[model samples]
Target: MIATRKLRRARVLIAGCGDVGLRCVPLLAHRAAAPRVIALSSQPARAAELRAAGTTPLIGNLDERRSLRRLAGLASTVLHLAPPQKNGDDDSRTRALIAALSAQRRSVARGATSAVARQRAWRGWFRATFKSSMRAGVKMHAKAIKRPSIVPDRVPGTAARPRQIRLIYASTSGVYGDCGGAWIDETRPVRPDNARAKRRVSAERQLRGATQRGLLSASIVRIPGIYAGNRLPLARLQKGTPALAPAEDVYTNHIHADDLAAILVLAIRRARPQRVVHASDDSDLRMGDYFDLVADAFGLPRAPRVSREQAETQLEPMMLSFMRESRRLQNTRLRDEMRYALRYPSIHDFLRDFLRDFRSEANAQFTITSVPVESPAE
Candidate 1:
């Protein structure tokens, strides 16, 4: 009887409950049904923080497979916000997460407690306690709530729904690589140039194949630069990190973190199967101009600009790698299909409003005029 209820609850599991994932928790309850939110954390230390944020914390490491068995059949809707590990061309973390989520129900059968003795002495007891605790909560969430599907009225793929677990993956727009500053959509073929993007491509491929095989219904959301009041270019400006000059600056894309959190919530049901949507805003600005906007807003000095040639010698490899790629994303699908109206439509729009609280009217005017930006409409 308890096992049966487990199948019903655990409605939404947020794999990576970091800043963006934390932002997603309340929105999930607000926009959709108030399904229980379970957060998966590798560190047990974060259990308190996760609980404080109104999510039931389930300790499971994506790097380790055994710890994830409890996650099997735990959530009907999964928000995969976990990123790939650093220094890899493939996302082993995603691979493990998929394996665990798709694992057989019987893999974690009762009376498995004794099995822990076979592992290394130091870590064995911990793994044993972890899995046993998950078993203790096998009754799942108290009672299943009435679900409200996030279907868009005008979207074509509403009908013919497949009965499978829903997985909404937060993929990066870097998968498209450099488009020579062209206005591109989802139809553009992916040409991942960096190891970072290659991992994302691998994740996309795995999700699409999973959907095809009916393992799970996956929705891929391609996101660009995510910024919020807390997440800004303040550090770079303070460090005086150089940006490319106007002549050599590459076009950049952005989506406010709050807006992104909202988009993820909407994509839970509105997004089509194996579909990709850009969570980008209509901010048509160069990299340097963007720095200037933030600098002016907070009354900070703008970062020094260097030409592309000079940047290679001055900037770190990571910064230079970002400078190499230049493309503008089209978010028509996000607006039309998901029907999500942006709360912060553009970086400029957000900065303009932010300036109100940041500085005086006289200073705000100076900030707006300080940065010269090109018109970019997504």
Candidate 2:
């Protein structure tokens, strides 16, 4: 279990509690102040794990207004790791939460009866306030929530007090979208040519706007490919999946999931809002080199290489396009500004460490399962 300091203790809410969220849960729960930790996930099974870990788990839709409002009231800090919504409107959920907070602030400003009465009324009106605020937020984004499958209907109440909150939105380095082998940093100009990259760029801007508007102390961490125990790409390679080899020219960056999580917690403690950080290891290896490492780790056959022309002809259009660009990410900002360091600083280091553990586990399981069964005595 990771220990936490008293200073870092604050009511923290983790939205979109997937693998990453679950990994962070123990860290938050171990705080010295024992800050109230709330986790929300649409999947009951996912929430159940958090509940077992002594967290208050709520099954709620990230896209629904009321769910976000309830979440905002309980948490002084929010971490967003949910998948982007369909269409171009990825900020809808965050906007809804902000609107709910604004309404609560307004209610407080208007002196809604007595403080005790207001608190009681806010508690009672939470569900309704969430619905209205969400609608208003969707409108601001020029999106009709009704068309989406995840959007919820309005529920009829007063907003709660708008408490101070900090937001850490996980983003992707794919925003750079292959910088043609050029080294890039937080200061690098983003020229996102692909649709996914373009959307990520837009999302980053929206997050910055929230910071500017004082909605929350916000920061963005543009992460690269993340791998860890169960989620590692090695497992897929071990299963005999053919690794795609695009042009050897397209370089890729990667970070261990543990390192990424640690950086997130570090950023929270540092409180450097409106900052953009790249969460990547020091090495930038080619895509083929990455797959080769995976193949070696799993004792699998080496991936066949193809000429650029053949690759373009045989691979999917999207895959070919992805292979066309190469970018090297520099994490100087994370090191100098955030004063952070990666535990797994190179792909080779990460692969070696992971494979060692994996092989040990495999050996142990084999030994356990290979024990000879005793013949039944007649």
The lDDT per prediction is 0.77, 0.65
Worst 10 residues of 2 by lDDT: 369-378
lDDT of 1 by residue, 141-172 (tens): 32333222432222221122223679999998
List runs of model 1 lying over 4 Å from the truth: 1-10, 105-163, 358-378
| Candidate topping TM-score | 1
Q: Please provide, for model 2 over 1-378, each residue's C-alpha lDDT reduced to its tens digit, 9 standing for 90 to 100.
A: 246564455677777676677777777766665677777777777766788876788778757777556653467777777656655635565566556545544445454434555555444565455577777874333243233333122212333346556888787776766677888888887877666566667767877786676556788888777766555454434444333445454787777767877777677767378888888889868877777876787676766677777676665555565576578889988889888877889878877876687677755531111100000000
Model 2 compared with the native: what TM-score?
0.74
- How many angstroms is residue 178 displaced in model 1 relative to the true structure, after the best TM-score fit? 1.0
